[model samples]
Target: MPLLEISGLTQRFGGLQALTDFSCRLEEGELVGLIGPNGAGKTTVFNIVSGFYKPSAGQVVFAGRETNGLKPHRITALGMARTFQNIRLWHDMTVLDNVRLARSAWLGYGLWSAVLRTPGYFRAEKAIEKRARDVLEMMALTHYADEFPKNLPYGLQRRVELARALAGNPRLLLLDEPAAGLNSADADDLIRLIRWLHDEFKLTIWMIEHQMKVVMSLCQRLTVIDFGRVIASGLPQEVRNSPEVIKAYLGDDTL
Candidate 1:
């Protein structure tokens, strides 16, 4: 079965329809891109899949199970995780703490176990710390573990967010505008890091990004949406060459 399958997803915000009849699937170990102009409904799909919003109509199946109404935390526990367009790390939390919190949600331990500090809780805490530290190290952010996200450079802050997502050991990862607000150097680093993580952990990543360089370099396939509808879907170069895609993106300067 596909790692993720979204079928006929439609979202309506009162009178505004954010998405309509959108369907996509990600096979295991694939890297895919979802792109579109501003207000093009890319984020809406991510939001719905991540359980932030219930779709007006459609089904989301992950690993062969329907996930339309599952909570975000429950989905994470099921081996899916996502990062946001904006950095969503807690400014007051240390980098390690941020990572730990994410892993904590999916770790094995009852609420009472934690409250009582049972042996199971201690074991679970140890597991969470080890997983968090390992992810930070893999992302090359170990030295900044004790630092606050607010103090890190933009690139490192982005890495911390990625580390938090990785701490859960997700099989399917959704990245929303990961390269936003970065310099060329940082963007290049992000491209390399994402590629390495995909290969190293065998992760299936689906991203929504406007930065053409990042998308073209990292994605194996590209899906383009315009005004909440799919306009193109194919190989990266093929989609880039599509007349409809070029028109939607308004020429190659952004494509």
Candidate 2:
């Protein structure tokens, strides 16, 4: 079975049909890319799959289970994690706290245990801390552990969000424009980092990225969308040369 499968998804907000009969699937340990022009409903698909929105029609089957209206937290518990295009860090907390909190779903302690500071609570807390620190070390963000995410540069803040998602130990990772708002140098670094993480962790990654260089360097397959419908789906090189795909991104100077 596919690790994640979204079938015949249709979403409508009042009268605006953001997505129409959209469908896609991700196999285990594959790196897939979803590319399109602005307002092509790419982010809407991610939001639905990640449980932020309940689609008007269709099913989201992850790991062979149906997850139509499940809450986002429940989806996270099912080994799915995602990052946003914009940084969504906690400005009040330290970087370590931001990453450590992602592991809260596995604490396995009740309110009474937390209030009384029981052994189980302590152990879980310690484990979460160690996991956070280890992930930070692995991602080379150890030096900023004590600092606030709001105080870091944009690139490092993006790394913090990625680290938080990884701390969840996910089987499926959804990245919404991971290379957005990055310079040429930083974009290259992001491409290499994403490639390394995919191979090292054996993760099933699906990302929505507009930067052709980033997607071409990292994705094995590409899915193109225009006006809430798929225009082309094929290998990266083929999709780039597809007439329909080129037309979809025609006037965009960013490509």
Candidate 3:
């Protein structure tokens, strides 16, 4: 079965329909791109899939289970995780601490364990720390593990955000414009890191990106949306060559 299945997904806010009849399927270990113009509802689809927004109509199935009504935390527990378009790191917290926070969500602990300092809590805490460190090392941010988010460069901040997301141990990762504000070198490094993580973690990645270079180089399959509806879906080359996609993103540089 496909790792993710989105069918007839629609989101309505008051009278505005953000998405309509959005449908797609993602297989295991595949890296797919969701591309569109600024207001094309690509982020809306991510929001729905990640449980930030509920769909007004349609089914979101992941790994054979229905995910339409699941809460965000519950969805994370089900092996799905996402990173936001904007940097959402705790600016005051150290890079390691930020990632450790994500790991804590799945720890086997309760109020009693915390109040009494039980062995279970300590054990879980240690495990979380180890996992967080591992992710930081993988992202080449081990040197800045104790540095605050605001102390790092913009590109490093993005890496820290990615580390936090990976700390959740997700089977499927949804990345929203991960390379948004980076120089060419930083963008290339981000692409390499994503490719490395995809293989190392055995992950299925779905991303919404406006940077055509990132989408073209990183994703094998592509889905294009316009006016909250799908305009095209195919391989990167096919989508790039599609007339409809060309029309939707016209006047911009991606040609």
Residues 1-255 of candidate 1 have per-residue lDDT tens digits of 898999999999999988989999999999999999999999999999988999999999998889999997888888988999999999999999999999766679998997999999999889888888888888888899999999999888888999999888899999999999999999999999999999988999999998999999999998899889999999999999899998887854753
Taking all chains together, each candidate's TM-score versus the true structure is 0.96, 0.97, 0.96
Runs with alpha carbons beyond 4 Å of true place in candidate 3:
251-255
Report lDDT per candidate.
0.92, 0.93, 0.91
Any residue pairs clashing in model 2, and if so which? Answer: none
Error of 2 at 29 (Å): 0.2
Could you say which candidate leads in lDDT?
2
Q: Per-residue alpha-carbon lDDT of model 2 for 1-255, expressed as tens digits?
A: 999998999999999998988989999999999999999999999999999999999889999999999999999999999999988999899999999999977877889999999999998888999999999998999999999999999999999999999999999999999989999999999988899999999999999998889999899999998888988998999999998888787765565
